[model samples]
Target: MSELSRWEDLFREGNLKELSLGAMKVTREHFGNSVFLRGLLEYSNYCSCNCFYCGIRRDNGRVERYRLDDDMIYAAVDSGFIRGLRTFVLQGGEDPEFGTDRMCRVVREIKRRTGDAAAVTLSCGILSRESYAALKDAGADRYLLRFETADTELHSYLRDGVSLERRLKALEDLRSLGFQTGSGFMVGLPGEDDELILRNIRLARKLELDMIGIGPFIPHPATPLRDAPQVPLEKTLLATALLRLFCPRAHIPATTAAGSLEPDGREKMLSCGANVLMPNISPVEVKPHYLLYPGKICLDEDGLHCIGCLGGRVAAVGRKLSFDRADGLICKRRDRVEAGT
Candidate 1:
């Protein structure tokens, strides 16, 4: 019943790749050769809070702020749908333009336009429980809220006084509302140790999360941690594999941050244990400005290009892109619900 002993053994004794192979097998068992694609639409970059590690934080005067109107957002989703995408992840900074009513309208419109064929995911920052419920009523199927780190002090330091309790409460609220809730952590963060990373994995399992997104800590030149060390690729891969080993059915992404860190990072992630790919379908002109960290890949490409490129990458790793809208963690949970166990 010791948490560390359970999760830590997978990392020791030069067994990183071995653990990855086991995780990959588990991933295949649950997901087959299908990798789900979520079209990423970064509709706005004007954030209200200034997280120390983010490039688009409010205090960073260099960021070019922009918010796409309803027409432009619909246009982007329309383009992605034509290219075989069935899920749209509406991500953005905490822009006030996307209030509860406006966001619900967007979600309702996307569902209406796609005949409910497209799954809408909201990744806008923390909102009230009422707002979360309203979005769900408007047909949003998934929600992503990264916990960032498991350590409370580290979370406070990184987010500039924000409490981890509030974040966890928001996650709980989302799950209570039947969202396929996702929470993530960063490997090699400024104050993180192996123990902290293992706790993060434990936390994900404890939450019964539907999905988890693990990526390396990449520093942004414009942020407070500009001089912090970049997370080693080996460490990040180890963390991804470990998450898969523990949470066998969670939807894990080969994050664009990883790919930007190493050219073949995404492919390696697929082999390691990842089962999701979020291609940037955001407005191309605004894509370059939505920099969470430096050196983000595929900013130069459009939605169609990302679809074709990621499709090729998925195939290269001997897996195929999944066209199913409900192919992620939510479907896996249905069995548990039906059995009432």
Candidate 2:
């Protein structure tokens, strides 16, 4: 059977044990038992776009909007680095006030502060090609822009008429600018189905993404999707395992959304195929305000406490938490080939 047909059969059979084992095998072949860690800094909750599913959407008047200045962001980075985090992911909403110039300065300062010892990844939403280039020049090592769904109509509806074509173009721009590009999607968005999930995996392969993050669709009470039916956590895990089989070398995170659904959700993901964990390093005081979905885990914990907690969790899964920059295997191979090594 063709690989596509094999995947379809695995999904249709509803045999998660077999699927998980296959994916785990692939993951071990490439990554062994080392789970990479990225420190996530949610620097802002002020998004311009009104995505139908998001808690911090601009239309949600109940959200207490906040943005961290350069000093505040730097302090957070310093704290994460001191905790032995070698990668810091600066994530925020699409706030126009924190535009290209300010972001470039922030990236440059991070590089300087860490003396180029750590990897910096930015997950701020869509920007112009020039802006991506400027950030790259400022020493940003990676970028993550999740399309959220593969169906164009669903993506447009969820994102207030923003085209999937535009999102794909932005991803292409990021790759062309030589950033270690990452993109991901929610597993159980309203209107999504098995076919769309397959398309999401195919699209990730086509993009040759360095990192792929998959999480369950958790509803926020303030958003339009509050009334939408919740998808089973099993569906999200199936998607995670399939993504691992398809993109074995790409970094996949055991997302906190998974953990929100169940006490052992993240651990379950790690056992299957996930090889990365992004512990929230954002200040505890502001974490409650940056809620993308309700019931997010670890909101009350400080950065140092989160590190220790995550370390224990990693050990429970029989995987060691790695503090290296942990660039994707594909990126590392390409760099070596380019240098004629």
Candidate 3:
């Protein structure tokens, strides 16, 4: 049988034990027992695009949108930094109010405050090449712009006519600008199949991404895909293991979406191959409003509390929670460039 057919059979039969073990072995070879932790700050819910599966899409009337000022953003970073988080992910929707200049200021100030102690990662969605270069110049070390899917038709449909080509272009821009680029896809989207999943994996490899985050698709009640069929979490876990085997050095996170699916879902992914965890450090009041899908965990918990919980989770699975900046291969390459090596 062909390699694709073999994987298809494994996925079809729901036999992931051997696959997961192999993935775990590869992860151990590369990352050892250290799982990097990134503090996720969802500072805004305002977005420009109206994606069908997103909870904070511009057309969604029910989400209470709010953007954090510099003071609030700084405070969140300070809190996480105190708790020993060296990597802070400033994530939000593509709000125009937080334009290039404002974002540059934010990145610069954060770097100033943290000195060389922290690395900042941005995930605010697609932007112009100039904007990306400006952010990189301002001290942003990593960028996550998930392409969502490899199938052009489903990608455009889910994103309301935004072509896969456009998304891929944005990723290329980030990479060319020397950002530690990260991208991912949801495991079970409407119209997604084994072929599409395989293609998604191939695309990640083709991009040579520094990070790969895969999560299961969960329906948001307020979005167009509210009534979409529920995808099994096992499929997502299988994909996670496969991603690990395929891209052993890429940083893969045990996404919150997995935890939302089951109480122990994130932990399960860790066993499979994931070596990173991003605990929500956004303010408690605004956490509920930043929901990309329903049943998101940790909306009520404070940053320190979430970190404490994740520490236990990591320990339970025999992995250490690393406080290092955990710069991936791409980020290291950027460092070498800046150092004139």
Candidate 4:
């Protein structure tokens, strides 16, 4: 059988151990035993869109919304920098207050504060091509916008009125603008199956993504899918392994949703193929309010505590936290350009 068929069979049969081991080998071969760190700053809980599965959707009146201004955002970056973090993912809902110019300034300020030694990653949802180009010009290095699922119907159903085609176009725009673009999907999303998961992996390879975030489906009490069941921990890990095998050079994170499902979820993912961990750097007071899903981990800890604890967990699995702001092979190309190669 071909490699794809082999992976499909393994996924269909629930052979997680074998799949994970194969994935680990693939990861080590491409990235060695070093895991990159991206300090996640959920700078805002306010969003314009009302996605059905999210906790902080615009319609969720129960959410205590908050948005950190430039000063607060810079302070968070300062804290992460002091904790040996060289990368920051400034993620938030699509808050209208963060206009293109304001967002550009945020990226420029972060780059300036770190003396241009940091990789500023943005997960602030979709934007126009002009906005994307503006941010890139302001020193943004990477952009993560998960397509959620490859299936169009499910994508529309989960994202309310948003179309999958639009999301894909945004991703392409990011790639064209010279950003290290990343995308991913949720495993075990309602109405999704094993074949769909395989398709998601294939889509990642087709897109030539620099990173893929494979997170589990965790239901939130405030959302429409509140009654939905959580995706099995094993299935999520299996999807992670599959992604690693398919996109060997892509950076996959042991997402926080995995850790919320089980104590050792992140550790297990690190062993499987995940080479990235995003410790929360948003202020401790706002962490609880930034909940995208219930029972999210590390909401109580600051950047210092989260990094310290994560360091021990990463070391426990025979890997070390990387200070490098690497976006798979994109970093290599940037280095080459700088060196006039």
Give the Cα lDDT of each candidate. 0.87, 0.90, 0.90, 0.89
Best-fitting candidate, scored by lDDT: 2
- Among all candidates shown, the one with the greatest TM-score: 2
Candidate 1: list runs displaced more than 4 Å: 1-7, 330-341
Candidate 3, 36-65: lDDT as tens digits: 989998889999999999999999999898
The candidate with the higher lDDT, 2 or 4, is: 2
- Listed per model in order, the count of residue pairs whose N, CA or C atoms clash below 3 Å is 0, 0, 0, 0
TM-score of 1: 0.95
Better of 1 and 2 by TM-score: 2
For each candidate in turn, the TM-score is 0.95, 0.97, 0.95, 0.96
Looking at model 3, residue 318 earns an lDDT score of: 89
The parts of candidate 3 lying over 4 Å away from their true place are: 1-9, 330-341
lDDT of 2 by residue, 243-311 (tens): 888888999999999999999999999987999999888888899999899998888988667777888
For residue 112, give model 1's deviation from the true position in Å. 0.6
Instruction: List model 1 lDDT by residue over 1-341, tens digit each.
Output: 56446546867554776877787888899898889988889999999988999999999999988999999999998988988889889999999988999999999999989999998889999999999999999999999999989899989889989989999999999988878898898888987888898899889988888889989889999999999998778888888888888888888998988899999899888888999999888878998899999998888888678777888999999999987775456545764786796
Task: Give the lDDT of residue 244 in candidate 4.
Answer: 88
lDDT of 4 by residue, 98-214 (tens): 989999999999999999999999998999999999999999999999998999888999999799999999999998788898899888787888889888888988998888898
